[model samples]
Target chain A: MASKTSSDITVIQPPRGWSFPNLREVWDARAILLNFVQRNFNVTYRQTIGGPIYAVYTPFMTMIGYTLLLGVLFGAQEGLSVPYPLFSFCALLVWTLFTNVTQNATTSLTQNTNLIQKIYIPRLVFPLIETCMQLLTFAIAFVVLLLMMVVYAQPFLWQIVWVVFYVAVALVFSLGFGLLFAGFQARFRDMSYLVQTINRLLFFVTPVVYDSTLLPAPFNTLYIYNPMALVIEGMRWAMLNVGEQPALIPTLSAVGVSVALLLVALLVFQRLEPTVADVL
Target chain B: MKPENAIEIDNVSKVYYVAESVTEARGRARVLRNLTSPLRRLRATLAGQSAFGAEIPVKALDEVSFEVPQGKILGLIGKNGSGKSTLLKILSRITAPSSGQVRIRGKVGSLLEVGTGFHQELTGRENIYMNGAVLGMTRADINRHFDDIIGFAGVGAFLDTPVKRYSSGMRVRLAFAVSAFFEPEVLLIDEVLSVGDAEFQKRSLGKISDVSRDGRTVVIVSHNLSAILSHCDLVAWLNKGKLASVGNTAQITSEYLLSSTFESDTLAGEKRFRDFVPSDKYPFELLAMRTYDDQQHVRSSFLNGMPVVVELEFKLGAPKWCTTTPSVRCIGCVGLSRPICSIRDRITSTRSCKFTAKMC
Candidate 1:
């Protein structure tokens, strides 16, 4: 042990306005970040028989439901370039990632009320852990999507590398909304229900079940502004060479909007972080 | 600001704005309030009225200021809801003070509650690492002391088992061991040590002493008087969100004990004479009485073989000479009441008289 010497002093007081979190302190606490992620992963599948296989199974079941509801019932596959299951499953991949990440992240602080009250770790870590945990599930579901694509013999295009960029967009978009809802959820609790309602509404607005081409001109133009629409459509255009490929200008604008939303989300989250424990 | 001081708390206060209706509001009212409060505030804002609504503000800490010198063990003694935990929370940076500030030198390890973030599904080893990380220990640091922690907790045999399987005592021991090894420059401990078996408590206390002796600062908040008396170099007493006293451990502990005894005495008196109504025609009236053990501590029940003392108080109507006799009645397990003993005393003119009787 080192000898007692008062070299560095940490001054604490009530937060007044927006202050950036100590990123260096967070970096130094990488072990805690990893532990949180690991704990969430472990606890999610603790007593389950299927364990992590359920991650893939959930999306697989959802894909079947969407295919039946949107593809067969509505005959929504008339305008798609690939099989209905492949296109819809591709959209479901991004949609599931967005919904799961945002939902988990929104409730992260409230769900860990015991830890929040008892200890001081960077509050951002909770949302980040939730995002990463959902990302892990998305990775598994992505593998399942690839298997389905092979089974359908959908031609894999060279543009598949662009899928990484779309995935990044989806991650940022989800985290941005997650942080926003989390700040309100910490105090309000009703924000979670609001988020769920919005997510359900968002599924219809985005090009998840039906192709964007099925929509009229102005609606098609406006739908890409939702960010997830562009991401899901771009992902399908890249991997399956199906769906209308969003123009470069609109895609770039959506990415810019997502990044801007992420910045705002971070600022709002930081402003609310200090008082989260008090409210809880 | 002094280099020798490890913590400088400057007039720090914490205030919580609580909704008074939260507890009493029924399901529909709660849902309505939750749904429409924001819209109402927005409407009020648009109408140029202040959006802040009515909320009851409770001050948990009131401008409390104290400093802990480097390498000293300071015990914070207070009753429940007396701001001891609030002060510790401010120090740990879990919750910020509403006003003023707290300055601490170097890293802080706060064990506000044992097994704070322990997930029941995780194995003991995993929880140790997770908890150690939460308490601000690096992975390498935990790795270095991993075996020592398991050995100290005596949970090495069950290291791979989930924490939910362990008894509560074993869980507390493991949690304490992980926190004790954190080795931060400043340590804040709440009443976590009061849990677990006596042997573990002793070892945990010894570990605390070892930490302080190694030239680190430790601030401990506990209700256990003996533990505070034995382990602390300085004692700070908090009463109702304010610092009541601060001094040497021995002196402060004795004063705190004396005050607490008086408080409990009054409390017991109130309970004993709650239904006693004084008559306007009497020259004197009995006020209150209670039993006490030999150690100056109040006792509500006495063992059959033990000697007991009964103390009583009476208010005199006028300052006239009076002879008062006090009698005791033993109530058996059945409905029968039997006369036990009686004591007689003659007193000169006085406004009040207090006397004690020893019963064999």
Candidate 2:
């Protein structure tokens, strides 16, 4: 039998204003994070016959639709040296990653109410796990994109390494929004529907299906400020070398804004963490 | 600062702000009242009273404080809505108290419900990892105890099957096995032991005792007084979010039973004659009858496998030349009562008789 000894003491009290999450506790629970990611990855396509193929199929079908509607029917320029299918597919990959991460992370807290009420783990792990799962899907989709690029005979520039940087920006950007919305969604259920509306409207404003140059001056300038647009366009610029070179100042500003939003989201999420179980 | 104290709670209180629905103002008089309500509200506000239509603040716990020494099992008992679960949630850090503080030593693992983080789509093997992780066990720890957990749960055959296909009992078994074997220094278990069959419950209780005897602290929140009396070294009783009493298991439980209306009248030996009317033909009266457990504690309810000792304390008006036998009847809800068993006593010439029946 082990002797009675107090190795450490955990002091808990009501949070006031903002509380910093105990990152060490989260680090200690890395196994739980891995399990959450694995469960999500498996359950996403558990009963489906296609299994992981659906990850590639979704963007493939969307790319075909955009090529027919925007490329041929609407006479929209591909805005890149690569074919319209490859061009729009690259943008679709980044857009899908952002949207999936944001929507899933936003609802992760509400979806895991049973776990939240019954156990004690780092609450931030849910959002982090959701983001990581979406990242895994993005990785799978990236493989499909690589295959498509090879078939299209698109030039693989040395700048392809920069795709990693753009993808990181996209992940941070969506995760920031996810944390913000998840905090509010835990309090007001209407925020879920509101996020859906905002995301739908954001799609039209983002340069996902069409290049930002297609829009007139003010709208194009305003659209450039959207962090996701910078990510999608930057990925295209790095991979295809077809789109205009991203302005250094604007891209750096987007990164700064994403980092700031992430900090704010973290603070808000930590403040609301203690009360989330009660509200749920 | 004492190394022996595992948990210390000081002046903890929780207040909930609940919204109140405003009824619709109807008809002429209601409209007039609604129109003038602002004036009344202003007057009340000037008089230092809360305005009507404000959110109601409910106090779930009020300045409750207690401490538990290491390596002891403490049982918390209370009626419904007495804030026992809230206190447990606070201790588990699921939610923070509205005021005051809680300090806990060592790694705290809480099992508020069975299969808390189990995903329905995941197989039993996968769920074991998920639930174990949720309970604060690392992947390596779970891997090391993998065979032991599967053996304990007896779900090895269904380990590869999805949890949704498993029966509820199997799920609970797997859940309890993982939690019990995780072996946290301080384990907070809610009423999860009440889920399974009699044998499972017995084994679960046995496992809890094993954990207790292993020199770890366990806090159990349960309504089953017998389980508490048998398992807990110390008991705390809560009434309406307030600490009613805390002491030795038997003392607090007995006091709680005595103060509450849950006690049986026969146990107190009060108004035994009123249980049944005396027949003029028989010239005999029933004095008192009650059931008790093996510990000699009077219990009005019993689990399926427990031994029951029924005692009949009665007065015989006339010591006639007839043998007196005490029989027990099984009554069904369909209003059918049949004599299932009886205990025959030798003929006695005494006015008072006491018959005891032991049924295992």
Candidate 3:
């Protein structure tokens, strides 16, 4: 055994801030993060009478609501040659995935305050995994949508592959928004209430409940700036063949904002990362 | 040279500013007005401020520095609010110090409370894994040692039960099991062994002793002098967050005990402590008590085997019999919980008599 001096031992001065700057350390801690995410995923529906059935129940309820409220009451606002039930179902699927994913991701760290305070892990991983877990639930809902479309005898063309692109767009939008708000909420805390209120108002503003194209000109162009608008509109076009292709400008603008928001959120979160523990 | 001193705390100081309640500082008129109504204080507190926010600076730790030589156990002893827990938290990385530096040599496992890292919703079996991982154990390693952990906790029957369902004693048992089962380079414990039944406490101490024997450094923060004396090799006596003394356990403990006893003398004994043992003869007679060193010089401190003197001041003629022997029991010499020892001496005095004897 080699004799050692006090200087030889590395004293980990209490790390400041939230970011795990050490790539090697973060990489080594992957198993721990994975385990934490798995534990949360299990806990969400574990031992409930409904069990994993809620994964089915959530989107099924949304689909039923959309059929009655939008399809029958409003008479299919998008004016697609497609049936009202299929059109409304497609919009509900995309909207549920985006909204639920963002809500769960942004608030994951705040809700698990005890674990965050006691232990140190890659803080970013919490929001990221939260996004993933909710997406897994969304995927279940997506499968239900596919089965419904098949039952209605909608043609399964190669164009159905376009659904993946729409899902990707929604996820990118959520991560961008979720990360920005997660960091903001950690500081101000009031942002959580604001986000919830906005999420409620967002339903009417977006193309989910009623198609945005039904709104008169100028307003439709303006509303597309809301990224979820382009995502939901694109989903309707691709999945239910509704409201034409929605023009390239709106789709391009959605992609631009998602990318820009993601960059800014990552930068801001990294900057405010340290001293999170002290503040919380 | 001995394993590079597992813990080296250099110039670490933690400062907490003490604050006073607003009610205490308010004027006489305000105090009376507040006493007449409780709703106003609640309203004031709800307005995002409180009287307790008024700053009164208290130095919880002041430039305290020490090291636990690798494989050596160190005891931290102090009075209430003397900065023992603050120092331990800084060393264990539970919280950051206001200033200064700390260097830890190896994987440091700390148990500052009975269940500092337990997840209440998790089952006993699951928490063992979660806690082990937090303390730096890999999954495969925990899996390999799972049986050993279950056996040590002795909670095999309830391993699948949620930790919230476990009694406090059961929680400590499982907590100690998970912590003790893991082999880390250094262990930091803070008064957790005081939990659980006496038999389990003994087992926990034995486990700690085994860890010490295995050449892993251990630093224990405790107010129990006997526990420290019996377990630790070196001790640092903290006073007002500074090191008052540091040396072998025997020397530091004896010094601490003597200082405490002297401090206790100034306190007017409590009315509840007024001894009135009705006897056949003279009920009870007060005595002049003086402790001395082995050299027979009048000294305030009596080390182990030194002499203690109890001089009595009494009146001889009374209705009760005068043949009763006076018994003296001095608690808190070792600690407040246990008596050091009791001394019985024959009492015969016209006015008063000074009783001098040796302390074992």
Q: Residue A247: error of model 2 in Å?
A: 1.8
Native-structure RMSD, model 2: 7.1
* Residue clash pairs of candidate 1: none
Worst 10 residues of 2 chain B by lDDT: B331-340
| Positional deviation of residue A38's Cα in model 1 after best superposition, in angstroms | 1.2
**lDDT per model vs. reference:** 0.81, 0.80, 0.69
Docking class of 1: acceptable
| Residue A93 in candidate 2, Cα distance off native in Å | 0.9
TM-score, ranked from best to worst: 2, 1, 3
Sorted into a CAPRI-style docking class, model 2 comes out as acceptable
lDDT (10s digit) by residue, model 1, range B208-288: 999999888999999887888789999999999999988799777766765665555546423355336554555555566
Return the lDDT, model 2, position B353: 43
TM-score of each: 0.82, 0.84, 0.77
Model 2 lDDT per residue over A28-71, tens place:
88888998888888998999999999887777899999999989
Question: Model 2's DockQ?
Answer: 0.41
What is the lDDT for B299 in model 1? Answer: 64
Best by TM-score: 2
lDDT at B194, model 3: 85
Rank by DockQ (best first)? 1, 2, 3
Q: Top DockQ: which candidate number?
A: 1
